[model samples]
Target chain A: MHLSPMPSAIVATELSKTYDVKVRDPGIKGALAALARPRYRQVRAVDNVSFSIERGDAVAFLGPNGAGKTTTLKMLTGLLFPTAGKAQVAGYDPWSGGNPFRQRIAFVLGNKQQLLWDLPPEETFRLNRAIYGVSLADYTTRRAELVELLLLGDLIDKPVRQLSLGERMKCELAAALLHQPEVLFLDEPTLGLDLEAQQTIRTFLGEYRRRHGATILLTSHYMADVTALASRVLIINRGRLLYDGELSELVARIAPIKRIELVLSETVSRARLEEYGTVAHYAPPRATLEVPRETATAASTRLLTDLDVADLSIQDPPIEEVIRIAFGETEQDAEEDTVRTDVQRAPP
Target chain B: MTRFTRAMIVLRAFWQLNWLEELQYRGNFVASLLGTIFWLVMAMLTVSLFFRHTPQLGGWGYWDVVVLLGIFNALAGVVETVLRPGIGHLPTDVRSGALDLVLVRPVDAQFYVSFRRLDVWRLADVMLGLAVSGYAFVQTGRAISAWELLAFAVTFAVAIAVVYAIWVTLMSLAFWFVAVENMAALFDAVFEAARYPVSAYPGALRFLFVYLIPIAWTTTIPASALTGRLNPALATWAAAVGVAALGASRVLWRVALKRYTSAGG
Candidate 1:
């Protein structure tokens, strides 16, 4: 028997980051008070989050806004120091600012830019070439390949301010990869892109990963990004890791029910649909039901035979629902019940 | 072949990029040149205004002070060309968390941050300043000696280093006081004092420049070398101060890096 090789790229253990953010009220009195005596509050941006990435693996970090996904990426890339626990990228401590570690990792942020705004993108490329100490020969070859791959021929000569958002993002990706870093941390890489531009970037990233075998940790609010690019997903909420495994496993664990849609030839009573399973939606000649994954096939067969069904299909629940459940939205009633039970049991 | 050579290559790349970027804004070139000329003329008038009151300042004639002013302008040009565009952005970078990109690169962060950007039009100020210094030297009827020329070259390099160290020291404070958006303004306010000879200042300001703030090393020492007024015995002291300034700045940079929690953190 033959086995595939494992690529070990990033290892992190219990990483955390706490920030002392200065807080002051809004008023002249507050301003004078702050000047006389400053006040600070400590907030935990990343609370003991831990995960690992295998080399050549693409992992999606899924979280809602302010869920510490960006903070964790910052820590892994050595942009921020962890208050507790250790993180190592390509076998070097990221926070050390050692040359070897920096050479091995790349970080790209959608909101922030490294390109020289007034200069052409090509100039920035040359600057990166010299700064990263790439040999002239290698620089020429890699640049040609990137320009071709990213389709950045005419865009490269235009000043960055003149380029469209999609063009700038393409050039940004080229700039980040100029040194061929083994580990890549991308935060919201697809944010604010149209459908076609998003698909273009997604395809480019997939191909880049396949060719380079780079370890990639991506964070995005768009579910399509994860479904298309990542096989494994890590879910975090409120600065804590909730789940980490294959994407399929996460769906199975959080939303065990599969959605079945039936296009009936005739209208069906809402009561009849309720007997089959949970009626998520009901309309003319159409009805949707959520059934247990194990019972999905049986339910679909029964619906087809019992009703004059024209068409029918089954799909796993959407990732957004899975994330909402992960964030404790579904457990609200249960939590309220527990609180009520505790209150009744309490002694006076 | 060496790290310094590699750094020079990086600097050259930045210079080319900066030059092309500046060329697009040709109008700024005119504005910058006008600003330099206006300031140069103002400096000369200030010298004349002072000469009206006294025959000499700190035992140096009018032309000698003019030469020092020229050196001051040249150093100011260096600041605008390199330091302002480079380190002047540091506080904002720290606030916005953009400095994270600077830290992750394979290059030395300090070196890259200090020389990564240049404002090309300001190089004109450097040329005009040297020309003014030359004219002042001629007006003083000072014959050029090989020794004096060599001394000027070395001390002028020292002046640049001293200026760079001051910038590094000031900008590094962004790590601790991340909200201070105008750190460069603080430098500008203080550096304005260096436009005049240190000895011409009141006793308290002289002490402040010599010991406390160390702006004396920026222009006065270099001008002394050019005007044949440098005490041969003091050359060693000037060299030592340059070395010490660089060393202290390096240590401060390390400390500041330690203090950086990054933007979000």
Candidate 2:
């Protein structure tokens, strides 16, 4: 793989974004204070973050609320100009790339919609075809393919507001992908979707990436989406990149414990279950234990021999738990970090 | 193809969609027509009352003022048909961050936002206004020359430009004051002054309308062209003012767009 380096589809170097949020206290005093002499607070949304995504790679950005995931995505999509640092998507400066750059990339925000509320989804699809300058033949072909892949039948012809949330999101995806962009920046694409819809989208996205060899960077709260689609994960907290590596590597480093479950013919006490490892659950004939990865096999063998075990299984803990611990470790430390304003610039 | 032509193609698609959506609400056409007729009657009644009180207003006959009124209605028709529904949504879009969708497209954001919609029903107001102008011109018994007709065409286009420039400037203010949800109302209040001729106003107001706000150029100059009161020099000056207004508005739009932080960040 190192013999030929894959071209970078998206790159950011020391990207930073800060907003001058207006400050005001509570009640009439604050209103009067804002009128008398307005005050502003410098809030750093994304601080000196840098990462790059190679062509044909699916990457996931994970962060808590207000963690600069959206702010960074906006900068890369050319919707916001960075206060400091630089970024290039599809080999063009996102802020100044103009039509050439926009044509090569697509952005989909889950909560916000681009479709016309009063009109049918097909109308928006046609509008995008014109906006992206796609030919009639190509547009027809691509729209049909997306419709089939996403299982959107007559839903595209109905008004957007009339459709359910899941149906609307499916149409939203089709609308964004009409141009067949090489790079996709999806922000919470599966947010607020039902399990069935989420799974549909995840599967479609995986197939779409495989078919087009497109580069995708997504942010999702659902670990299932991350596990199903992304090959790499980037953990961001407090406007900084904490970890960027393979998902498996992150699991190995953050959570080095394996979970063991036992189905015994006889009921077991909590103390007996704890004798093997940390007792996760103890309910009659069924109990769960969290044991160190190095001793998980031995602990499972001992539990099987010592107790009247009927069935047993060992597996790594859920990715959500691992990520929760990752975020917890940095929650307090970020508060103590000093605010750096040396490179702050006026809003563009 | 050039970017402008491609943008036009996209705009055509949006307008087609708008037309289709408008077709779903056919009752609105009847309502809009009735509203236009009612306003026309009220406007003419107001002018009739003024005519009874005086032979001429500011040294012009009743029909001349009616011609200007007709021109005013025609321009208002353009606003309702195109500018109002299109650029009028800017403040709300900016506040709600809906403008993000427009910004991401390959087309020009200002151009797309300015002409993305058309109220087809209000287009009836345009034909009605023009019909009223023709009837009044016949009543004046003035045979229009080719030169005057040509000047009217230029000045009329200049009128639309001036009005559109006003809209762009007003809507651009949303980038700074995101909370001012209906900045278009301020424009409507100011545009009400363009109904009567600038000559009918006192010296201070005449100067304000002519030099400061420039609403006088919207209806007065174009009506003056049809009335044979416009000189070649004045028509050229009106054209120059139209271009300057457009240039200034475009510059303001660029500056203001940079300040769009996009809500829900």
Candidate 3:
């Protein structure tokens, strides 16, 4: 992973969290037995994982469910204390919350709202100004800028409960940024938004980053969100950091092949396409092939030269598929290695 | 600026914003005011029923209990206007992880959580309660001295402190027992006892009220001062209890917060 020389906005070392999970059985006898003495099992929610985020970098955190993505964000934002190790945000220890530190950071939870329920989003915006002590001049400037960019003309005046989910999320984002925070911790900011709203928010965040150069550590299940907004990615699985590097680099390393589709002027024989590459899909006048990255050029040339191919395109497989392949191999390795998923560092 | 001044600033901001939000719903003001007045009338009728049977309650005249009842209403007003709308949200915040917003602010979480919201109409309870107390005071035909008035003022401040402390202690328990979201109901149940003087209850119940839960300090002592029945030593004791309650609640809050497992954490 490439990191700028700027001082780190976030530093987490050996961070871990464990919970005492209630264990119950699935029968009347088990329930009666549990009533006599309730049982609990120690479940490690986050293992000893370490990483540093450089200032002004937008990094995506990706993981399957219960993979500790939210737990790590919680510890870094001072909402939860790690059972062990240390974390710092903007040079201030997050667990030891002080106004100066908190004032410099902004966190947005996708489903949760910071806006007043009965009041309009504008009220929440002003409340944030007061809480952060943002000056009147600065608040006005920031509010106008956010309103314009977010297209929040009458939206801010409408009560939060009356707004649509996409509108509410836009207001939530505006509420978060009114203080001009230096760092942002986003947890699935585009969780349930439609495709258009998702693109709008992704574009807005990209602009915000470019404008303020704020350090962003975003965790999202949406591949488009991560791909469009974050240049680097961190993948965690089962409370462990499995991969940390550029998104493209991880994809190249794990899924080293591309898919090619051809539109032929006439029907092409399956045998003819098989001679060039693995025919993944075949139809009367079109075909798709999976070719090795190094051999894709040769295969495309062979197809164009021999066949009446009218049009052709080459594309990488969906990022989700790439990640799935990478995760599958790791899980298999982990199962063989005694199911040890809590490795301290991700394998390069 | 000092932390206290900073809190004052934040409180001012919250108040201004809330007031504006409330302005949008003008009918809420009238509706809540009528509701409070109706409740006050019912309360007075209930007291009259008690007086109809006995000439006095626990050796105190009818008007004396009215004074106590007035003080009770006033304290309840403070809870409604400030403490309830502010710290009353703590349990839900803890459960929903909304406290994350409060915890991240640069301000003192305890102070911010306690004064961030206000039910503007509830302040009317304070005025009406004081009006009733003054009317009952005049009915006693006792010329209250300047010293007694000073004592009343001090004891009233202590009453607010005690009530605030009780709220803090109750809400802080959300950290440990997140599912008990209705802990404020426990406070309301116990506070019902404060509507009458501590001496009016049976011996065991009186002892429990005055010493165990200390509801006596919240309303009984302040009313006692207005009625010119306050023991100087007890007034001093009330002040001490108020300070102690505040200190204890602050300590308990810190300890309870250590158990906070934020949402998705």
Candidate 4:
């Protein structure tokens, strides 16, 4: 199979957002005081964050709560303007309300949807067809295709309020893509979905990207979503871009160690496992060892030969662990490695 | 096809869907019909009560005022059924950031926002109001002339335009004061005065309604045409007012859209 060249789909420079939140204290006294003199506070939701996406690329924006991922998505989708920065989606200034630009993009928020609550998804589809001015032939064909792809058979006729969460999400996706937008911004699209539902949505997203060659920027707390769909990961923390690169590079940058798990034939002492590497977990008949990348093979070989190893396997540390360490949980481990290396290299 | 025909298609789609959706809540039909009747009866009683002490109010008799009240109810129906349900969603949309979906659509955002939804059951008020106005015309024993009918048509259209302008102006403020969640209520508070004819109002209130806030234009000018009391020259002025109202609302909508930094981001 041949690979296609990447094309630029979205760009942003120094994107920033600040909200003027009204501040007031509690109680009747505070209310009276506020009535006399109101106080205002400016909260910086997204501060000078920037990134770009290429066509046909599925990028996952991972961040903790209040990390500005949703804010950045909103600005990129033309839902909100930056407090002070430049941003563009499909060569149109998002804040300008340009028709051509609007026609080229779509947004789906997990918590918020555009479907009319009292009406069936089909009615919304019809309304969208007219609102977007899509041709009847194109609308019918696209609706049929999306229905088949998303498996929205009986769900489309039911009122949106009557659909289940996962079912509604499927309809939301179908409605969003009915116009065939070139750029898709999905915020926590798999949120509130069960495991099977999550897999279904991920599969649909993969197929959608393959078929349309559309640029997708998705944010989700589910790392499985990231690992499955995103070739590239953009990690953000405290409203800053901590890392931006391929998923492998992020894992390598943050976690250079491989974990080796062993199922011992007999109960192995913790000291024996510690001699080979740090014993992350020790239990009867099972032990987990963390070894440096260079010494992974050596440590695994020793565990098999020197210990009562029943079954042994080597794998990268869990991505969740890597993410936690990147957020400063493993600083002591890094410090210990520094001391141990200094001691080893002293006079050997 | 003309722009009007295209707009009609859009409106027809909304109307059909609105009907189907509203049909689910069949109880609301009786509730709304009763609510309209109650308000109509209250308005007639107010006219009757006023006429008990005097035969004419500011030179117009009881039937003329009732005719004006009927026009007021019809315009109110237009507002509650269409404008309020439609444009009233603007403030919440602004607050929750749902307006993003609307702004990105290919159609004109203002036009779509204003006419996208309909409360079909409230349209009963429109028919009932026209019925009351016809009854009052009979009581007045005035032969309806062709010119009066034509003038009434023009002015009633103008009334709709004016009411639409009021809504646009009110909803436009949502952009500036994003926290003002009850902006539609402000329109409702002022629109209450339009239930009475402009002449029944005292000097200060009349002046305020006609000139300052222009709520009186919603019903008084139209009822004037229907009562054969409209000056031919003022009909031209009313048409000009209708054009200016639409133009001003459009300009205000543009300005409001500019200030919308959106809600979430």
Pick by DockQ: which candidate is best? 2
TM-score (all chains, Cα) for each model? 0.85, 0.89, 0.86, 0.83
Pick by DockQ: 2 or 4, better one: 2
lDDT of 3 at B128: 87
User: Which runs of model 4 end up more than 4 angstroms from their true locations?
Assistant: A1-7, A25-41, A256-324, A327-348, B1-9, B176-183
Output the number of the lDDT-best candidate. Answer: 2
RMSD of candidates 1 onward, in order? 6.5, 5.2, 6.0, 8.4
TM-score of chain A of each: 0.75, 0.79, 0.77, 0.74
Q: How far is candidate 1 from the true structure (C-alpha RMSD, Å)?
A: 6.5
Q: Tens digits of per-residue lDDT for model 3 on A1-348?
A: 875666699998999998765556799998887678767656678899899888889999988667799999988998888989898899899977577889899999997888888888988887787778888999999999999888788999888889988889999999999988889999989989987889889999999999999999999887778889998999887678878889888767765777789899977789877888888789868788988878988888888888888999987655444666676655465465433333322321
Q: Which ten residues in a row have the lowest lDDT in candidate 3 chain A?
A: A339-348
Candidate 1 residue lDDT tens string, B1-265: 4778878998898888877877789999999999999999988998899899999988889999989899999999999999898987788888998888888887778888888778888999999998999999999998988888887888888888888998898888888887665768888999999888898889999999987788898889888988887877777777888899999999999889978877654
The CAPRI class of candidate 4 is acceptable
Displacement of residue A109 (Cα, Å) in model 4 is 0.7
Candidate 4 residue-wise lDDT, B1-106, digit = tens: 4556656767777877888899899999999899889989987997899899999987788999889888888988899899988987888888888887777666
Residue range with the least summed lDDT across 10 consecutive positions in model 2 chain A: A339-348
> Which prediction has more favorable TM-score, 2 or 3?
2
Error of 2 at A20 (Å): 0.7
Better of 2 and 3 by DockQ: 2
**Per-candidate interface DockQ score:** 0.59, 0.69, 0.55, 0.43
Predicted candidate 1 versus true structure: per-residue lDDT over A91-189, tens digit per residue: 788888477788788899988889989878888888888878888898888888888888888899888999888888889999999898899999998
